[model samples]
Target: MLFLLSPAKSLDYETPVPAEVPATIPHFEAPRGPSTELIRLLREKSPQQIATLMHLSDNLSALNVARYKAWSGRSTPENARQAAFAFDGDVYGGLDARSFTPAQLDWAQAHVCILSGLYGVLRPLDLLQPYRLEMGTALANRHGKDLYAFWGSRIADHLNERLAADRTPVVVNLASQEYFRAVDRKALKARVVECVFEEWKTDRYKIVSFHAKRARGLLARWAVLHKAATPRALEKFDLEGYGFDAEASAPERLVFRRKT
Candidate 1:
């Protein structure tokens, strides 16, 4: 089984990663190809323009502008860190990759895939340079109006390649809607299963953004720890007060609810 996740905007490169988890090269390079073109377009824009485009403060915009300028095509352990270790958003907080053992990381490296605006698709151990370009950004590129247009069928094709190597070849989509939209479902050969995490609110079960995001990471963590290879194994996931709701779940969409 393969898992899909969204890249985080918040980064934590300074935090020391576990010495056992060795960093590897990203499956695809952004600096040399279409991603390079996107960066080129970004370089043309001023910090103020960037702030306006991404809705960032002056300081954040300045920081990203420096990051964009410093982003050389070449990535090394000295210059870049692994995607899993670099990200520190809510989803990543639950993932807590820094605590994982090398063996667990090895399992994750094969099963987990992180979708990105600049990098397109990344494996867990893939080396990444710091930059903030969300998948939903409206940055016009040569392909069309947005990053989606530029990525087109490329991401889907890459997923297919990864799935072809897997025995089960099922995609567990833990990414948010905005990031998942980048993947061309029709182009993919593997069966896609969307995981939904909901909370029992006043009236009924509903998806709370923050809790659901963390739950997604928890599920990913479960998969890696258990070395889950089948879709059925996913339903057994029970962590952080979440339990699989068989009645609420469908074949394509697995629902896990927490009564908190």
Candidate 2:
């Protein structure tokens, strides 16, 4: 089921975009690391001891014991696959058990969307891991189709940021090939237009970006385009038809025609 909201009353469907956000990212908290006590303890313990504690914490403190165990199986692969899965599970896929009545569970569907809003806060590949079945089941039951839509919209917003300015506004960085392939390129571009115009309903920003790239070389353009039905009129999402070969990269951004 698609989530629906009324378009802004003033949008002409010709020019729409969320108030542009500052190019600079706001400062965030310090990165994660062992606490002082944990660091001390690690110094005193061996690798086996450290792994034992970690395993115990994860194994014993989980929400659904049976489901978590089943998902993990008798043993872990202990290689690239295992590490990749572990990283993915850390944010978007993992156990978060809870007991609630049918109504409560239904509400959680939206609140705990995509295995607990992990997809929103985390990278896309983070969802492609071994998740606790109990938690995933809850999310799927609650959202139906809204979860996927919400997830798509989130990525689309990110794409807007990457494409909102000059063809080479900041940098061309892709943490992983998986990131670029995270979503359907064409559909994601379309969704970016929808999300930007939707947010524009309130915020008073002007210009925005719509990224696209295809093949080795293509036009990387960001013109003030038009949207449909939404409040703004100048919302554009047609990369290929405009002579720009579009290939979705990290967060599914559309790459531009390479420079000569």
Candidate 3:
């Protein structure tokens, strides 16, 4: 089984990561052309243009501008951090990768993939530079209009390749729609199962974005901790108040609901 997750915009590179887990280069660049092309394009844009494009504040835009300028695509332990450890959004908060043991990280490195705008697809231990280009961003590229077009079927093909090696060959999609859309569903050979987390509100069960994102992270963490090898193994996940709702679930969509 393979798990897909979205990269976080908020980063925590300042925090110290455990020294035991050595950082690895992202597969996008090595043995290939420079992956810094996106950064090159980004660098062409002025800070003001970037601010308008990404709808960021002056300070945030300037910060990212500096980041893009400093991005060398050549990542080292001293300059860059692992994708899992650097991400500090709600999802990463629940993932808490800093607490994961070396063995758990090893499992995650093989089983998990993080979808990104700049780096394309990343493994858990992949080294990453700090930047903020969301998958949903409308940055026009040579491929077409958006990042999705630039990525096209490449992400799907990579996932299919990874799935081909797996025994179960199933994709557990924990990523949001924006990120998942980057993957070409028709090209992928693996069965895709989406995990949904919902809360029982006053009237009905609804998906709260914040809670659902965190739940996705928690589920990923649980899967790594237990070394889930199949989609069926994931059905047993019951993290943070979430319980699998078989009645509400379908073959493609697994629903987990929390009463709170």
**The best candidate in terms of lDDT:** 1
Off by over 4 Å in 1: none
The CA lDDT at 17 in model 3 is: 85
Off by over 4 Å in 3: 31-34
lDDT measured at residue 214 in model 3 versus the true structure, 0 to 100: 97
Model 2 regions more than 4 Å off? 1-138, 141-147, 168-184, 187-260
lDDT of each: 0.90, 0.24, 0.89
Q: Judge candidate 2 at residue 200 and give its lDDT.
A: 25
Consecutive 10-residue window with the lowest summed lDDT within model 1: 26-35
Estimate candidate 1's alpha-carbon lDDT, on a 0 to 1 scale: 0.90
Candidate 3, 11-76: lDDT as tens digits: 997888878887888878552433677787899999999999999999999999999988876888
Write the residue-wise lDDT of candidate 1 on 43-162 in tens digits: 999999999999999999999999999887778988899999999898998888877888889999999999999989998899899999999999988789988998999999999998
Please provide, for model 2 over 150-175, each residue's C-alpha lDDT reduced to its tens digit, 9 standing for 90 to 100.
24444445444433653422222212
Give the TM-scores of the predictions, in the order they appear: 0.96, 0.22, 0.96
TM-score of 3: 0.96
Residue pair clashes in candidate 3: none
